[model samples]
Target: MGVATQLVVALAIMCAVLLAVAFFLLPSRSNKRKGLIQIVVLGDLGRSPRMQYHALSIAKYGGHVDMIGYLESDPLPELKAHPNVNIIALPNSPRVLQTGSKLVFIVTAPLKVMLQAWSLWSVLAYKTEASEWMLIQNPPSIPTLLLAIIVCYFRKTKLVIDWHNFGYSILALKLGRNHPLVRFSKVYEQLLGKFATAHFAVTDAMGKVLRSDFAISSPVLSLHDRPAPLFVPLLPSERIAFLTQHELTAAEANEIIDGNTKLIVSSTSWTPDEDFSVLLKALCEYSTSAITDSPQLPELLVIITGKGPLKQHYINEIEALDAKQELEMVTIKTAWLSFEHYASLLGVADLGVSLHTSSSGVDLPMKVVDMFGAGIPVVGYSNFKAWSELVQENVNGKGFTDAEEMAGVLKSLFDPANNQLDVLREGALKESKRRWDSEWKPIAGRLFELTT
Candidate 1:
């Protein structure tokens, strides 16, 4: 072989290398296509406000969004009305674990995961574009995240997990903390959480847990739930109308204003995590106490909103109390209200109470957020880190550990002369303005950047 022949071979090799580099560096045809974001929530879509808010946020940017979730709950009208959003409703699967015993959950874990994987895989299989993204809401079924991770891996799509709470912590409420299934769930959650392209925490404390427990160095964003657009403070007339519409007679409305009666509201999902009994027990304690000689401590009109599995149990307890007719200091009423009605109640109520202690000890309750938006003060049970973020003792709201403490908090708030409730109402409004005014649009914008 001659030197000239060797030179020709080197030149050909160099040309081939340059051509390969160009092909690799150049943008693919997928990037040239319209960018669309996909969101898959295995949980109840109609019930999950977080999922509804996420869909609305994505639509704000005029980006196309495809939402896939269970049909157990009703879809948000706002999401349905959005031109850029397409909600894919799947038949609600029987959640054997959530409603059944620990033994049932453990026994059905394999089947549950397989079913979820198949549901997710069926929809994800149609994603034809690369660099597409999916934000998944988690907790009741943790393995759904694992399924999303696998689907994303094969499709080269970006995967984001919005961690509301750990599934194990919730499972522990039914199964004891020492249950092997709970232990396995905790391990699985932490291990799988790290595989996501990014993580969104419901609270800062939740983000820390992801870091400490999961060792997730992935980009974690704290995307807290805020008040919906409809949660504004009510006008005097609007408040009266809301009360009247709910069977408050003109005389009763006058009594409320004259300090002969007061309306207290609390919203709950009726889950084990939310101990509604705590609020009821507190009301019982408050009713028995002769804290003041004046009748103006006000005969209580306690309204509890939300529908859940335990709703019937609480309703029966309230009815039994009503049957006794001995507790004249307070009257109990339970309602499974629509968001509009719920927001109106929050807007008109004098005080709001939250019995949620954070099922995971990390996720903050959105009920307090809605209350704050309506300029209603809250007295929520303390879980220390998560609930404390919103209910800053005497700032926007108060925190209690037990029913006795909660009763005491309620007593002070109901005191007509103290003017403490007025100050707390103002604080709640101020905090709500500061927090919710920021909006989820910017947060969604940052999340969309993950696709880039």
Candidate 2:
């Protein structure tokens, strides 16, 4: 062969070998991950319901999640059991009761953030991978985001923020809206939100505000909370066992079951944001109107759940009301239930009432979502934009403004002859199923898209 021809053929052969090697290495590197993404969650972990849900979604989608959060009570078994998730509880995230007074918490807030940021920095420096993302929950807002911006900048990792509510709006709740701290929080949130690569809002309304008001140019996703799988009707035997376990007498069981007593359940965090006393006044009105001597009137039972600052005051009020014995047709009960027990209560209850008026008129209450999952009709107060999406008068449930109107709606729901409750319950079931099958998965899928 000629020297020129031999040289050209050898060069072509070398090119072919290089192309083959490149193709081989590409798929091998991509397939090595098996589509698994590594995510680290930093937030008010154990206490925040939405944050916990986010972690569960990541773990379920084959992601390796390092959840850096605090444990307020017992650890959630479902999250702990997931093989892909590791729960790294921090020292500062404790229950509200453990935090002493609101004033003390406010005074020491900066120091608390510094300590927590230092702890988080150590974890990210030693353990984080280049491809890993830091998903943070906001409102306690600036400190965490500032720390994330610093750490992620150094690590060359992306920061994703799941905005629940603005931390400044919460400050407005405690301090006045005009407070200098509140102003600072507002400016800081707007500025720091731009630092995130992606932002997820719990409601679409919040998303609009993020773009228009906060001017966050990052990719924004809306992922609302879905019903946990556990919220479902109890089997006949399971209902009987639950009653027996609670040590309910035969007559009490009959009152709940065969007696057709309308069981109304409500939950709250007992903060100033929620005016549970409005629910109390409505119950009073309900009991007063029951004196009409209608033989078909189903007895009423109100069950309130959760512990907070005003819990003792409300407990005292409820006890005094119970002692008065003027509520001939109504009975009251309250307890701080575990997740399993809470779901069971929702399953068996005839209806649920939500007294949430929104802390800042930005976020929707989660209690209503739990009720819808159990196929229980709810009476909710329409105080925010998101509630309008979840609640409809005489459709899925009823909404009201004041105690008197709320009382009237409650009576109409519990009225024996009317089929309103049944119709609303059916709507709730349909909405719940639709939310699970069609709505939630696609929105939640957005989180995975961020890693790509």
Candidate 3:
């Protein structure tokens, strides 16, 4: 507030910066590691499966990896145990960021970002083993992309951006497209996004947008998400036990054990991007319609897993449906599962449902890939053009436009007379043969100059 106070704050920052520089200049720390690849994520390292895959793939290919991010949850055990992988966690968010008032946010957002950027720089410049290449995840791209650009410029490291989705578009979801913040984020990303040494797009549609819209000169590749080796069919015993403990009542458990119920699984972050109400309405309709079907349709046991701000909102909606006894034919269970448990549950599911309506219409849901990896076909919302890239209608999976279509597809797939579910299951098993390592190798082999 006063000149002396401001000068003291500024002096302390200068001293900290000088000390950081001096510490890294020491002979032991000065030997910048050769052939080490840095993987940076602004989000939680454990929740970010794609970046974890990047680290694991590098380690698997005999390259050393330094993964930097917040360690909010445990990453894959394979990555933790890898001899070549070293995880460097950044400091968690500052306390001021947790405020509920808009006025407080307006005053504190910049301070929070400055704190975050300083922490990131500490890891990049001091904590990590300096490498020739740094791969960063986007969509939390505000200060992260700028920080990476600055650090890479100073250290002479090649910066790589893994574009999961447009950060501006995500911002626009809450603040409309015309919001100043959204516009600024768009300009910011476009201006700095071109500085990357390379770009990895999650879909080809995104690749086209980068090249044509962003006018990026660097190599842009479509590095689609594929299932890690961890996703596989759970053994029958484990599946039964899992359902019995968490999902089914005693009678329902007996029904499940007796093969009298169909296990349907869907994973959602429960955000506006994914309209979960569609899934619920579809289930209610399906339950009511199936009550009078020929051969008496197998009761549906639906499990939904994930956590988000809208979770309680939807939980209340689920409760309301239950009050009316509208969900009699279908029993819905919701849980926030660990990554391992999520994978296991998907593995044992009879069918998978995806309600992901991409905000940009170009980004694909990684959850669908996980489900397919578990050898279960998906019933995805088909409105987005990119859905075809992952979910092939009547083949490995089918696509639906609304509740009516989703209900109809469910009935046809699960009906004992047609055996449609078996056909899709076989197709999914075939699709599961395509794994992440095979997809990662060629691009990584080229990017890092490694022989695969």
TM-score of each: 0.86, 0.83, 0.88
Residue pairs with backbone atoms closer than 3 Å in model 3 (clashes): none
List candidate 2 stretches off by more than 4 Å.
1-44, 93-106, 126-131, 235-237, 247-251, 292-296, 326-328, 435-440, 449-452
Of 1 and 3, which scores higher on TM-score?
A: 3
In candidate 2, what are the lDDT values of residues 109-159, reduced to their tens digit? 544554565566555544444445777877667566776776667555668
Evaluated against the true structure, the overall lDDT of model 3 is: 0.82
- Ranking the candidates on TM-score from highest down gives 3, 1, 2
Best by TM-score: 3
Write model 1 residue lDDT over 1-452, tens digit each, in one string. 44433543454345446534543454333341245777788867877887777777777766678888887756767888889888887655555635555455554554555456555555655433443787888785554766577667766678888888889898888877876567867888888888898988988999998888789998988888788777878988898787776663344677676667878888777888888878878877777773445454668888887778888988888777667653568877777676777788888888888888776788888888888888888888885578766677777888899989988887888877788888888888886674442656567566685222
lDDT values, one for every candidate = 0.74, 0.70, 0.82
After best superposition, candidate 1 residue 31: deviation in angstroms? Answer: 9.9
Q: Is candidate 1 or candidate 3 better by lDDT?
A: 3
Q: Model 2 Cα displacement at 82 (Å)?
A: 1.4
Once fitted onto the true fold, the runs of candidate 3 whose alpha carbons sit more than 4 angstroms away are: 1-31, 94-111, 234-253, 292-295
